[model samples]
Target: MLYWFLKWVAIGPLLRVIFRPKAYGVDHVPAEGPAILASNHLSYADWLFMPLTLPRRVTFVAKAEYFTTPGIKGWFQKKFFSGAGQVPIDRSGADAAEGAMKSAMKILAAGELFGIYPEGTRSHDGKLYRGKTGVARLALESGAPVIPCAVVGTDVVAPTGKVFGQWTRPVVRFGPPLDFSRYEGMSNDRYILRSITDEIMYEVMRLSEQEYVDMYASKAKELTKAAKEPVEPSDATSSAKKAS
Candidate 1:
Protein backbone atom coordinates (compact mmCIF):
# COMPACT_ATOMS: atom_id res chain seq x y z
CA MET A 1 0.00 0.00 0.00
CA LEU A 2 2.73 2.46 0.92
CA TYR A 3 4.64 1.44 -2.21
CA TRP A 4 1.80 2.12 -4.64
CA PHE A 5 0.98 5.39 -2.90
CA LEU A 6 4.43 6.73 -3.64
CA LYS A 7 4.61 5.14 -7.07
CA TRP A 8 1.54 6.93 -8.35
CA VAL A 9 0.90 9.84 -6.00
CA ALA A 10 4.41 11.10 -5.40
CA ILE A 11 7.74 9.84 -6.80
CA GLY A 12 6.30 8.71 -10.12
CA PRO A 13 4.76 12.08 -10.88
CA LEU A 14 7.91 14.00 -9.97
CA LEU A 15 10.34 11.77 -11.88
CA ARG A 16 8.17 11.59 -15.00
CA VAL A 17 8.46 15.36 -15.29
CA ILE A 18 12.13 15.80 -14.28
CA PHE A 19 13.62 12.97 -16.29
CA ARG A 20 11.03 12.82 -19.08
CA PRO A 21 12.11 9.25 -19.80
CA LYS A 22 11.22 7.65 -23.10
CA ALA A 23 10.18 4.00 -23.12
CA TYR A 24 9.73 1.37 -25.82
CA GLY A 25 8.16 -2.12 -25.89
CA VAL A 26 6.36 -1.38 -22.62
CA ASP A 27 3.61 -3.70 -23.76
CA HIS A 28 6.12 -6.51 -23.49
CA VAL A 29 5.74 -6.33 -19.71
CA PRO A 30 3.09 -8.77 -18.58
CA ALA A 31 0.08 -7.14 -16.96
CA GLU A 32 0.18 -9.99 -14.42
CA GLY A 33 2.42 -12.69 -13.03
CA PRO A 34 6.14 -12.87 -12.22
CA ALA A 35 8.56 -11.40 -14.75
CA ILE A 36 12.15 -10.22 -14.62
CA LEU A 37 13.40 -6.99 -16.21
CA ALA A 38 16.99 -7.67 -17.30
CA SER A 39 18.91 -4.75 -18.67
CA ASN A 40 22.31 -3.24 -19.27
CA HIS A 41 23.31 -1.03 -16.37
CA LEU A 42 24.85 2.29 -17.36
CA SER A 43 24.28 4.75 -14.57
CA TYR A 44 23.08 5.23 -11.01
CA ALA A 45 20.07 7.00 -12.46
CA ASP A 46 18.93 3.70 -13.97
CA TRP A 47 17.53 2.57 -10.62
CA LEU A 48 15.57 5.73 -9.72
CA PHE A 49 14.43 6.48 -13.25
CA MET A 50 13.53 3.09 -14.72
CA PRO A 51 10.83 2.18 -12.19
CA LEU A 52 9.15 5.54 -12.67
CA THR A 53 8.53 4.70 -16.32
CA LEU A 54 6.88 1.38 -15.62
CA PRO A 55 3.19 0.96 -14.82
CA ARG A 56 3.66 -1.82 -12.29
CA ARG A 57 5.69 -1.45 -9.13
CA VAL A 58 9.13 -2.95 -9.84
CA THR A 59 11.33 -3.93 -6.91
CA PHE A 60 15.15 -3.93 -6.90
CA VAL A 61 17.48 -5.67 -4.48
CA ALA A 62 19.37 -2.68 -3.17
CA LYS A 63 22.66 -2.67 -1.31
CA ALA A 64 22.18 -2.64 2.47
CA GLU A 65 23.95 0.70 2.81
CA TYR A 66 20.97 2.48 1.29
CA PHE A 67 19.11 1.42 4.43
CA THR A 68 21.89 1.78 7.04
CA THR A 69 23.03 5.39 6.97
CA PRO A 70 22.92 7.27 10.30
CA GLY A 71 20.37 9.83 11.52
CA ILE A 72 17.40 11.63 9.99
CA LYS A 73 18.51 11.47 6.37
CA GLY A 74 19.18 7.77 6.82
CA TRP A 75 15.78 7.26 8.38
CA PHE A 76 14.12 9.03 5.49
CA GLN A 77 16.17 7.16 2.92
CA LYS A 78 15.34 3.78 4.39
CA LYS A 79 11.61 4.51 4.54
CA PHE A 80 11.53 5.99 1.07
CA PHE A 81 13.43 3.12 -0.48
CA SER A 82 11.39 0.57 1.44
CA GLY A 83 8.08 2.19 0.60
CA ALA A 84 9.15 1.80 -2.98
CA GLY A 85 9.42 -1.95 -2.19
CA GLN A 86 13.17 -2.33 -2.40
CA VAL A 87 14.81 -5.45 -0.95
CA PRO A 88 17.98 -4.82 1.03
CA ILE A 89 20.94 -7.14 0.37
CA ASP A 90 24.40 -6.93 1.93
CA ARG A 91 26.85 -6.05 -0.85
CA SER A 92 30.09 -6.29 1.13
CA GLY A 93 31.71 -9.27 -0.56
CA ALA A 94 31.22 -12.70 -2.18
CA ASP A 95 28.23 -13.39 0.02
CA ALA A 96 26.46 -10.37 -1.47
CA ALA A 97 25.73 -12.24 -4.71
CA GLU A 98 24.22 -15.16 -2.83
CA GLY A 99 22.14 -12.82 -0.69
CA ALA A 100 20.82 -10.80 -3.64
CA MET A 101 19.77 -13.87 -5.61
CA LYS A 102 17.99 -15.24 -2.57
CA SER A 103 15.88 -12.08 -2.34
CA ALA A 104 15.29 -12.09 -6.09
CA MET A 105 13.86 -15.58 -6.02
CA LYS A 106 11.56 -14.62 -3.18
CA ILE A 107 10.12 -11.70 -5.13
CA LEU A 108 9.55 -13.78 -8.26
CA ALA A 109 7.96 -16.67 -6.38
CA ALA A 110 5.38 -14.21 -5.09
CA GLY A 111 4.28 -13.38 -8.67
CA GLU A 112 5.75 -9.87 -8.67
CA LEU A 113 7.97 -7.97 -11.02
CA PHE A 114 11.68 -8.37 -10.24
CA GLY A 115 14.10 -6.01 -11.97
CA ILE A 116 17.73 -7.03 -12.26
CA TYR A 117 20.80 -5.80 -14.10
CA PRO A 118 22.54 -9.05 -14.99
CA GLU A 119 25.72 -7.19 -15.82
CA GLY A 120 25.85 -6.94 -12.02
CA THR A 121 27.03 -3.34 -11.72
CA ARG A 122 26.86 0.01 -13.49
CA SER A 123 28.69 -0.15 -16.82
CA HIS A 124 31.57 2.28 -16.67
CA ASP A 125 31.68 2.71 -20.46
CA GLY A 126 28.00 2.34 -21.33
CA LYS A 127 28.45 -0.95 -23.17
CA LEU A 128 26.74 -4.28 -22.82
CA TYR A 129 28.78 -6.95 -21.10
CA ARG A 130 28.50 -10.60 -20.21
CA GLY A 131 25.66 -11.32 -17.83
CA LYS A 132 25.98 -13.30 -14.63
CA THR A 133 23.96 -16.52 -14.30
CA GLY A 134 21.90 -15.47 -11.31
CA VAL A 135 19.15 -14.19 -13.57
CA ALA A 136 18.81 -17.57 -15.22
CA ARG A 137 18.88 -19.43 -11.94
CA LEU A 138 16.16 -17.19 -10.55
CA ALA A 139 13.85 -17.62 -13.52
CA LEU A 140 14.31 -21.36 -13.64
CA GLU A 141 13.80 -21.71 -9.95
CA SER A 142 10.71 -19.52 -9.82
CA GLY A 143 9.05 -20.20 -13.21
CA ALA A 144 9.28 -16.53 -14.26
CA PRO A 145 9.83 -14.98 -17.67
CA VAL A 146 12.66 -12.55 -18.46
CA ILE A 147 12.11 -9.17 -20.12
CA PRO A 148 15.26 -7.80 -21.72
CA CYS A 149 15.72 -4.04 -21.37
CA ALA A 150 18.06 -1.24 -22.45
CA VAL A 151 18.54 2.22 -20.92
CA VAL A 152 20.36 4.88 -22.88
CA GLY A 153 21.74 8.42 -22.34
CA THR A 154 21.82 8.24 -18.54
CA ASP A 155 25.58 7.77 -18.40
CA VAL A 156 25.94 11.34 -19.60
CA VAL A 157 23.50 12.52 -16.98
CA ALA A 158 25.52 11.15 -14.08
CA PRO A 159 29.04 10.33 -15.20
CA THR A 160 31.78 9.60 -12.72
CA GLY A 161 32.87 12.98 -11.35
CA LYS A 162 32.59 15.44 -8.49
CA VAL A 163 29.69 17.07 -10.24
CA PHE A 164 26.26 15.45 -10.09
CA GLY A 165 26.44 16.38 -13.75
CA GLN A 166 23.50 17.51 -15.84
CA TRP A 167 20.38 15.64 -16.76
CA THR A 168 20.00 14.56 -20.36
CA ARG A 169 16.71 13.37 -21.74
CA PRO A 170 16.96 9.57 -21.25
CA VAL A 171 15.50 6.71 -23.31
CA VAL A 172 14.60 3.30 -21.89
CA ARG A 173 13.67 0.56 -24.29
CA PHE A 174 12.00 -2.66 -23.11
CA GLY A 175 12.39 -5.44 -25.57
CA PRO A 176 9.98 -8.36 -25.76
CA PRO A 177 10.31 -11.05 -23.14
CA LEU A 178 12.19 -14.07 -24.45
CA ASP A 179 10.67 -17.25 -23.17
CA PHE A 180 12.96 -19.92 -21.76
CA SER A 181 10.19 -22.43 -21.28
CA ARG A 182 12.36 -25.13 -22.76
CA TYR A 183 14.30 -25.14 -19.54
CA GLU A 184 11.20 -25.45 -17.41
CA GLY A 185 11.67 -29.11 -16.58
CA MET A 186 15.44 -29.07 -16.82
CA SER A 187 16.27 -26.64 -14.04
CA ASN A 188 18.86 -29.01 -12.64
CA ASP A 189 21.06 -28.73 -15.71
CA ARG A 190 23.77 -26.10 -15.44
CA TYR A 191 24.06 -26.00 -19.22
CA ILE A 192 20.40 -25.06 -19.50
CA LEU A 193 20.97 -22.18 -17.10
CA ARG A 194 23.94 -20.94 -19.08
CA SER A 195 22.03 -21.12 -22.36
CA ILE A 196 19.07 -19.20 -21.04
CA THR A 197 21.28 -16.59 -19.43
CA ASP A 198 23.15 -16.08 -22.67
CA GLU A 199 19.90 -15.76 -24.60
CA ILE A 200 18.76 -12.90 -22.38
CA MET A 201 22.12 -11.16 -22.67
CA TYR A 202 21.93 -11.36 -26.45
CA GLU A 203 18.63 -9.53 -26.50
CA VAL A 204 20.02 -6.89 -24.12
CA MET A 205 22.99 -6.35 -26.40
CA ARG A 206 20.72 -5.73 -29.35
CA LEU A 207 18.42 -3.41 -27.44
CA SER A 208 21.16 -1.33 -25.79
CA GLU A 209 23.24 -1.46 -29.00
CA GLN A 210 26.37 -1.32 -26.92
CA GLU A 211 29.68 -2.83 -27.90
CA TYR A 212 29.60 -6.44 -26.77
CA VAL A 213 32.59 -7.69 -24.87
CA ASP A 214 32.74 -11.38 -24.01
CA MET A 215 34.26 -10.33 -20.69
CA TYR A 216 32.29 -8.69 -17.92
CA ALA A 217 31.82 -4.95 -18.46
CA SER A 218 33.61 -4.32 -15.18
CA LYS A 219 36.76 -6.04 -16.43
CA ALA A 220 36.59 -4.33 -19.80
CA LYS A 221 36.44 -1.05 -17.91
CA GLU A 222 39.73 -1.84 -16.20
CA LEU A 223 41.38 -2.64 -19.52
CA THR A 224 39.87 0.49 -21.00
CA LYS A 225 41.37 2.62 -18.24
CA ALA A 226 44.74 0.96 -18.63
CA ALA A 227 44.80 1.52 -22.39
CA LYS A 228 43.81 5.19 -22.22
CA GLU A 229 46.31 6.24 -19.56
CA PRO A 230 48.38 9.34 -20.29
CA VAL A 231 52.14 8.74 -20.29
CA GLU A 232 54.21 10.64 -17.73
CA PRO A 233 56.28 13.46 -19.16
CA SER A 234 60.08 12.86 -19.33
CA ASP A 235 60.57 16.47 -18.17
CA ALA A 236 58.86 16.59 -14.79
CA THR A 237 56.51 19.58 -14.50
CA SER A 238 56.28 18.94 -10.74
CA SER A 239 59.88 20.17 -10.06
CA ALA A 240 60.16 23.92 -9.36
CA LYS A 241 61.85 25.96 -12.14
CA LYS A 242 65.64 25.72 -11.78
CA ALA A 243 66.91 28.69 -9.69
CA SER A 244 69.59 29.37 -12.33
Candidate 2:
Protein backbone atom coordinates (compact mmCIF):
# COMPACT_ATOMS: atom_id res chain seq x y z
CA MET A 1 0.00 0.00 0.00
CA LEU A 2 1.07 3.58 -0.62
CA TYR A 3 0.93 4.46 3.08
CA TRP A 4 3.29 1.69 4.14
CA PHE A 5 5.60 2.21 1.18
CA LEU A 6 5.97 5.93 1.79
CA LYS A 7 6.27 5.47 5.55
CA TRP A 8 8.73 2.60 5.69
CA VAL A 9 10.55 2.79 2.35
CA ALA A 10 10.37 6.40 1.29
CA ILE A 11 9.59 9.55 3.25
CA GLY A 12 9.70 7.98 6.70
CA PRO A 13 13.32 6.93 6.50
CA LEU A 14 14.34 10.27 5.07
CA LEU A 15 12.56 12.22 7.78
CA ARG A 16 14.02 10.14 10.60
CA VAL A 17 17.46 10.87 9.26
CA ILE A 18 16.77 14.58 8.99
CA PHE A 19 14.65 15.45 12.01
CA ARG A 20 15.65 12.64 14.38
CA PRO A 21 12.25 12.43 15.99
CA LYS A 22 11.93 11.00 19.50
CA ALA A 23 8.91 9.54 21.23
CA TYR A 24 7.97 8.78 24.80
CA GLY A 25 5.07 6.93 26.42
CA VAL A 26 4.53 5.05 23.18
CA ASP A 27 3.73 2.07 25.36
CA HIS A 28 0.57 3.88 26.31
CA VAL A 29 -0.83 3.09 22.89
CA PRO A 30 -2.87 -0.06 22.91
CA ALA A 31 -1.21 -2.98 21.19
CA GLU A 32 -4.38 -3.52 19.18
CA GLY A 33 -7.83 -1.97 19.04
CA PRO A 34 -9.60 1.21 18.06
CA ALA A 35 -8.34 4.40 19.79
CA ILE A 36 -8.20 8.11 19.16
CA LEU A 37 -4.95 10.06 19.34
CA ALA A 38 -5.85 13.62 20.28
CA SER A 39 -2.96 16.03 20.00
CA ASN A 40 -2.23 19.71 20.20
CA HIS A 41 -1.88 21.47 16.83
CA LEU A 42 1.40 23.32 16.80
CA SER A 43 2.79 23.09 13.28
CA TYR A 44 2.53 21.32 9.97
CA ALA A 45 5.22 18.88 11.03
CA ASP A 46 3.06 17.58 13.89
CA TRP A 47 1.47 15.14 11.48
CA LEU A 48 4.81 14.07 10.06
CA PHE A 49 6.54 13.42 13.36
CA MET A 50 3.61 11.88 15.18
CA PRO A 51 3.34 9.04 12.69
CA LEU A 52 7.04 8.31 12.94
CA THR A 53 6.55 7.59 16.64
CA LEU A 54 4.07 4.78 16.13
CA PRO A 55 4.06 1.48 14.30
CA ARG A 56 0.41 1.69 13.32
CA ARG A 57 -0.81 4.47 11.09
CA VAL A 58 -2.62 7.47 12.59
CA THR A 59 -5.18 8.74 10.12
CA PHE A 60 -6.08 12.44 10.45
CA VAL A 61 -9.01 14.14 8.81
CA ALA A 62 -7.53 16.67 6.41
CA LYS A 63 -9.22 19.51 4.58
CA ALA A 64 -10.75 18.45 1.26
CA GLU A 65 -9.21 21.53 -0.36
CA TYR A 66 -5.70 20.12 0.04
CA PHE A 67 -6.56 17.19 -2.20
CA THR A 68 -8.30 19.43 -4.74
CA THR A 69 -5.57 22.04 -5.07
CA PRO A 70 -4.70 23.05 -8.65
CA GLY A 71 -1.27 22.81 -10.29
CA ILE A 72 1.81 20.65 -9.87
CA LYS A 73 2.36 21.44 -6.21
CA GLY A 74 -1.26 20.56 -5.56
CA TRP A 75 -0.78 17.28 -7.34
CA PHE A 76 2.20 16.44 -5.18
CA GLN A 77 0.38 17.46 -2.02
CA LYS A 78 -2.56 15.33 -2.95
CA LYS A 79 -0.39 12.30 -3.60
CA PHE A 80 1.66 12.74 -0.42
CA PHE A 81 -1.37 13.24 1.83
CA SER A 82 -3.32 10.43 0.23
CA GLY A 83 -0.31 8.16 0.47
CA ALA A 84 -0.03 9.12 4.13
CA GLY A 85 -3.57 7.83 4.78
CA GLN A 86 -5.22 11.17 5.49
CA VAL A 87 -8.96 11.31 4.93
CA PRO A 88 -10.22 14.42 3.18
CA ILE A 89 -13.42 16.09 4.39
CA ASP A 90 -15.07 19.39 3.41
CA ARG A 91 -14.74 20.86 6.97
CA SER A 92 -17.58 23.31 6.31
CA GLY A 93 -21.01 23.63 7.89
CA ALA A 94 -22.82 21.10 10.09
CA ASP A 95 -23.26 18.74 7.14
CA ALA A 96 -19.50 18.57 6.70
CA ALA A 97 -19.09 17.79 10.39
CA GLU A 98 -21.55 14.94 10.08
CA GLY A 99 -19.65 13.63 7.08
CA ALA A 100 -16.35 13.75 8.98
CA MET A 101 -17.84 11.89 11.95
CA LYS A 102 -19.04 9.20 9.55
CA SER A 103 -15.60 8.90 8.02
CA ALA A 104 -13.94 8.67 11.45
CA MET A 105 -16.51 6.21 12.73
CA LYS A 106 -15.79 3.99 9.76
CA ILE A 107 -12.09 3.97 10.55
CA LEU A 108 -12.75 3.20 14.21
CA ALA A 109 -15.23 0.53 13.30
CA ALA A 110 -12.41 -1.12 11.41
CA GLY A 111 -10.25 -0.95 14.56
CA GLU A 112 -7.76 1.61 13.27
CA LEU A 113 -5.91 4.40 15.01
CA PHE A 114 -7.56 7.75 14.32
CA GLY A 115 -5.56 10.97 14.84
CA ILE A 116 -7.24 14.28 15.56
CA TYR A 117 -6.11 17.76 16.53
CA PRO A 118 -8.65 18.78 19.09
CA GLU A 119 -7.59 22.41 18.65
CA GLY A 120 -9.17 22.20 15.18
CA THR A 121 -6.34 24.33 13.67
CA ARG A 122 -2.64 24.87 14.16
CA SER A 123 -1.68 27.37 16.83
CA HIS A 124 -0.34 30.62 15.44
CA ASP A 125 1.90 31.36 18.44
CA GLY A 126 2.86 27.91 19.68
CA LYS A 127 0.43 28.03 22.60
CA LEU A 128 -2.16 25.34 23.19
CA TYR A 129 -5.62 26.51 22.19
CA ARG A 130 -9.10 25.45 23.13
CA GLY A 131 -10.01 22.06 21.74
CA LYS A 132 -13.12 21.57 19.64
CA THR A 133 -15.78 19.13 20.79
CA GLY A 134 -15.53 17.07 17.61
CA VAL A 135 -12.96 14.92 19.37
CA ALA A 136 -15.35 14.17 22.19
CA ARG A 137 -18.12 13.53 19.72
CA LEU A 138 -15.96 11.03 17.89
CA ALA A 139 -14.90 9.25 21.08
CA LEU A 140 -18.43 9.10 22.43
CA GLU A 141 -19.82 7.90 19.15
CA SER A 142 -17.16 5.30 18.43
CA GLY A 143 -16.48 4.06 21.97
CA ALA A 144 -12.79 4.62 21.42
CA PRO A 145 -10.54 5.74 24.22
CA VAL A 146 -8.88 9.12 23.61
CA ILE A 147 -5.09 9.11 23.99
CA PRO A 148 -3.73 12.54 24.73
CA CYS A 149 -0.58 13.32 22.78
CA ALA A 150 1.81 16.24 22.93
CA VAL A 151 4.01 17.13 19.98
CA VAL A 152 7.00 19.30 20.68
CA GLY A 153 9.49 21.16 18.45
CA THR A 154 7.33 20.71 15.35
CA ASP A 155 6.50 24.41 15.21
CA VAL A 156 10.17 25.10 14.66
CA VAL A 157 10.55 22.33 12.10
CA ALA A 158 7.57 23.33 9.96
CA PRO A 159 5.89 26.47 11.19
CA THR A 160 2.38 27.40 10.25
CA GLY A 161 2.10 29.48 7.03
CA LYS A 162 5.63 28.64 5.96
CA VAL A 163 6.57 25.86 3.55
CA PHE A 164 9.24 24.49 5.90
CA GLY A 165 11.80 25.51 8.43
CA GLN A 166 15.06 24.38 9.94
CA TRP A 167 15.28 20.75 10.92
CA THR A 168 14.94 20.07 14.64
CA ARG A 169 14.52 17.12 16.92
CA PRO A 170 10.81 16.64 17.48
CA VAL A 171 9.35 14.83 20.46
CA VAL A 172 5.97 13.14 20.69
CA ARG A 173 4.62 12.03 24.07
CA PHE A 174 1.62 9.78 24.27
CA GLY A 175 -0.42 9.86 27.45
CA PRO A 176 -2.74 7.29 28.91
CA PRO A 177 -6.03 6.95 27.09
CA LEU A 178 -9.08 8.71 28.51
CA ASP A 179 -12.28 6.73 28.53
CA PHE A 180 -15.77 8.23 28.13
CA SER A 181 -17.87 5.12 28.01
CA ARG A 182 -19.95 6.42 30.93
CA TYR A 183 -21.17 9.14 28.61
CA GLU A 184 -22.26 6.52 26.13
CA GLY A 185 -25.25 7.45 24.00
CA MET A 186 -24.88 11.07 25.08
CA SER A 187 -22.96 12.38 22.07
CA ASN A 188 -25.79 14.78 21.35
CA ASP A 189 -25.40 16.42 24.75
CA ARG A 190 -23.35 19.54 24.06
CA TYR A 191 -22.40 20.06 27.73
CA ILE A 192 -20.99 16.56 28.07
CA LEU A 193 -19.09 16.95 24.83
CA ARG A 194 -17.46 20.18 26.04
CA SER A 195 -16.56 18.60 29.35
CA ILE A 196 -14.91 15.63 27.72
CA THR A 197 -13.03 17.83 25.26
CA ASP A 198 -11.74 20.03 28.10
CA GLU A 199 -10.53 17.00 30.02
CA ILE A 200 -8.54 15.76 27.03
CA MET A 201 -7.09 19.20 26.34
CA TYR A 202 -6.01 19.48 29.96
CA GLU A 203 -3.83 16.40 29.64
CA VAL A 204 -2.38 17.67 26.39
CA MET A 205 -1.55 20.97 28.04
CA ARG A 206 0.13 19.20 30.93
CA LEU A 207 2.21 17.16 28.54
CA SER A 208 3.14 19.94 26.10
CA GLU A 209 3.53 22.57 28.88
CA GLN A 210 2.55 25.28 26.42
CA GLU A 211 0.71 28.36 27.59
CA TYR A 212 -3.02 27.89 27.55
CA VAL A 213 -5.11 30.16 25.33
CA ASP A 214 -8.85 29.89 25.90
CA MET A 215 -9.77 30.98 22.37
CA TYR A 216 -9.88 28.71 19.38
CA ALA A 217 -6.69 28.61 17.32
CA SER A 218 -8.48 29.99 14.26
CA LYS A 219 -9.81 32.92 16.25
CA ALA A 220 -6.40 33.52 17.79
CA LYS A 221 -4.85 33.59 14.34
CA GLU A 222 -7.49 36.05 13.15
CA LEU A 223 -6.88 38.32 16.13
CA THR A 224 -3.14 38.08 15.60
CA LYS A 225 -3.51 39.01 11.93
CA ALA A 226 -5.73 41.94 12.80
CA ALA A 227 -3.22 43.14 15.36
CA LYS A 228 -0.43 42.98 12.80
CA GLU A 229 -2.34 44.89 10.09
CA PRO A 230 -0.94 48.37 9.43
CA VAL A 231 -3.14 51.19 10.63
CA GLU A 232 -3.81 54.03 8.17
CA PRO A 233 -2.42 57.46 9.02
CA SER A 234 -5.94 58.97 8.79
CA ASP A 235 -7.24 56.42 11.30
CA ALA A 236 -4.32 57.03 13.61
CA THR A 237 -4.83 60.81 13.45
CA SER A 238 -8.54 60.41 14.08
CA SER A 239 -7.83 58.25 17.12
CA ALA A 240 -5.25 60.79 18.38
CA LYS A 241 -7.75 63.64 18.01
CA LYS A 242 -10.45 61.69 19.75
CA ALA A 243 -8.08 60.91 22.60
CA SER A 244 -7.13 64.63 22.87
lDDT by residue (tens digit), candidate 1, 77-180:
99898988797984544798888988888788788999999988888766678888889988887778899999888888777542576778888889888777
Question: Which stretches of candidate 1 lie above 4 Å from their native place?
Answer: 90-94, 226-244
Query: Which whole-number lDDT from 0 to 100 does residue 239 have in model 2?
Result: 94
Taking the tens digit of each residue's C-alpha lDDT, what string does model 2 give over 1-244?
A: 8899999999899999988898999999998899999999888778878988899998877778889999999999998898897988746447877778877888899999999898987888889999999999999989999999999999888887898788789999999989999999999999999999999999999999999988898898899899999976798799999999
Q: Report the Cα RMSD per candidate.
A: 4.5, 2.9
Pairs that collide in candidate 1 are: none
Best candidate, lDDT-wise?
Answer: 2
lDDT, residue 156, candidate 1: 82
Q: lDDT of candidate 1?
A: 0.83
